[model samples]
Target chain A: MTAHPDMHETESSVREFSVSPERLRLTPEAIERRIGYGDESAPDNVRAAIEEMLAVFDSADPFRCGFRILDPGQVAFHPDRIVCGKVIFRTGSIIGRGLKGCSALALLAASAGPDLSERGRVLISEGRELAGYVLDTIASECVEQCLEHLESELAAATASWGWRLSNRYSPGYCGWDVVEQAKFFSLLHENFCGITVRSSGLMVPLKSASALVGLGENAERKDYECSLCDREDCIIRNDG
Target chain B: MKETSSILQSIAQCIERGKVNRASPYPPDLRDRDGADELVRRAIDLGIDPQEILTDGLMTGMKVVGEEFRAKRIFVPEVLMAAKAMTAGMEHLRPFFASSQATHRGVMILGTVLGDLHDIGKRLVGMMVEGAGWEVIDLGTDVAPEDFVAAVERRPESVVGLSALLTTTMMNMKETVARLKEAHPETKIIIGGAPVTVAFAHEIGADAYAPDPPGAVDFLNSTVAEI
Candidate 1:
């Protein structure tokens, strides 16, 4: 139920946290892996594209993240809906089971800046498909790094309470309905990290991701629960 | 003729290395050298057939890219760069191709189904197919069943490809395949993306499913050969 001291005071009901780009340090190897290269050396052209994309990301400080912490006691779980404080989440058994033993929950949203997505659009328009693809992939990595940063911050904040952290669970993964993203967003301030949910439940910027992390003594700390799902093409599942 | 053949071979090499033109700085070894664009143009100026430039130069290079991609020796960024280089060479030959002075292997209509704005996979498939000497009519993202049906009607001989990145949006692909099949049962339909699998393709009654762009190209080639 406690908010981080670094949260920016807003006029709206939502609490906002300020996350810097310094925290989201993406590595070349990680970027390569995300683009499906794995441990193998990327081709020269692919490596060059990654370098160019890293330069673009370096010149701009466009990463941002916002989150809110909720007490587990305030969350109510049902068959098809989860009520967290004032917000109601229309989730399923997957999310329900995932968050079972949490003393606290962190609702987070992060983006790799709007300009990154804009640059992708411009590159696509100019027929720079390679550049666009690299940018998009890098943006995804950047957002993931932002989540990593957020998880570290949460770990630090909760260590005093002897709480362990569960890996982040995102809507649209592990059978959680993507439509629940609207409810997750409702708890955050408007324009949180400059990411907007589309009518189709897809996040705008196309590179933004929202996730929930459980914090408690009993929370299981492990890699993503990909084995529980049937998505055959999941990169995380395949990598594991 | 020997010089012209050499130029075509150079163009193919440029594409494999992802050198777009003299102005492009990629593949640092090829920096400041005439790339696919110039080499392709020079081949045409030397009276090399436009179709020869396409088949012997662009398609040959893309075939290597496809093989390497399938083998996991290269990834998306590499394939995309090669596609860009192939596109640079193809631009010069478009006029000849449109005038029927050059021939394409077949036509393909590609798109991401409705409610899905993700098109990177679809675009990659389109580029690879185009580089493989197929005429690709990209319908872009959020394409409805009607748009696909309309495009199929316009190019009755064309194959159709549907891509979707989200599990939620993947249902739209099934609906699109069903509609396309009901309307033009003879048209070949291929589906792919992050969430699509061969099993899903079969369940949806799609003609084929490719896990990646190169696989899509291979499917298109095999299907067209059957016809």
Candidate 2:
């Protein structure tokens, strides 16, 4: 529970850490107000501030490597990395939840086009695509911590179930809705780990993630999921 | 209610009203007076056993909040306030609980299923469950199947709860639940959070599903009784 000596001085120090816990209590009301401002322009002062801070994000590298696919819809993309595993996972995932649960939906919402490629590929993103990729690194770090804490508890749950995990994948990864997240959420019953979309399909926990990984037998296909990806050019996507 | 009953009842009322302290401006009616924290402390100094203080005072307060949340009379922020009030009372007894000087109602291992990383909902559940007298082992978010199975192995009879906030990750809950059942038949599994339903709970082969914290506590009480 001890903070690393210079942890407070590190770049990882985001807004949450700057406030005292007594003053830092986040509220649902705040989240509700912030949830669907995707297309709304930031207030002038806010825009001025964010554009400055956005650079920290813009200069960032792709998460070691990343990829593209909206699953079955053949639109949007998600680039991921295992970063760390077998113990704990420290990772982050990023994408605009906009008016849909996944960016794939966002692209679909704004796009009207056909794929010349037989595989259903389309170009919808603005240039400087690498900026979008930086979020994956943050996601990987966040995920790594989540996995670590989970592992500690699981170690106590089954007295050692002797099971491991499969690499994480999304529904649309192979040809699923990556768009109809509502379907998969209904199945989880936690609504993608307890977050959900509005009537318009905007996901709450704006920067959160939803993935699918198998156990034992299915995980053996990790490499299969990797090689079959649509963003074959993505340099950060975990090949394993 | 008599003096003791009134004191306990007051605690529950304050919690339901979201009055945190003597100075809290919330529930303007209760302005400038002791809330759960002060009342709970006074109850302790008056010679009440800490455990009864918890079950009768703090737990009762939490029960009201949990019910309100279930009824949609309140949402996450309000529920969180009530929980914070409950914790204010709980902080007084942490050492006792830690020393086995007080008993935790039961143990719950909770987490968000793998491929999902939303923790607010899961954290709320963990906090409220812990405040309600259970020993909560929170695994944060994005938990994998092996993690669930492993935790069960360590605490054979403990209850397990899974959370998922995304549709994509929710499917992983079924995979996780299936894996846990395959590994430990006796482990009681409960699933909850925004998109969950009792029907979906059954679909995953889970033993129970609570839409909110109180329902989970009720199921836990039953599970403990059966033991």
Interface RMSD of each: 2.5, 14.9
User: How badly does each model clash, as a count of residue pairs?
Assistant: 0, 59
Candidate 2 lDDT over B1-227, as tens digits, reads 27777787887787777667786665657878898778888877777778887888888878877877777555554665676677677878787787776788789999988866666567667867876789888877778899888988898768999987544577788989899999998788999866566778889899998766777778887888888
Highest DockQ against the true fold, candidate: 1
Off by over 4 Å in 2: A1-176, A179-205, A208-240, B99-101, B195-199
Please tell me which predicted candidate would have the highest TM-score against the true structure. 1
lDDT of 1 by residue, A1-240 (tens): 244323334332134455554446667788888888777877666777788888887765657786776655666656455677677776677666776766667787888767887888898798877777888888888888788877887777767667788778888777677777877887776788888887667888677899988777787776657666666676457545
Report the lDDT tens digits of candidate 2 across residue range A68-168.
11122323223332211121111113211111222111000100001111011111023211122222222333333333333333223212333334344
Candidate lDDT values, in order: 0.81, 0.53
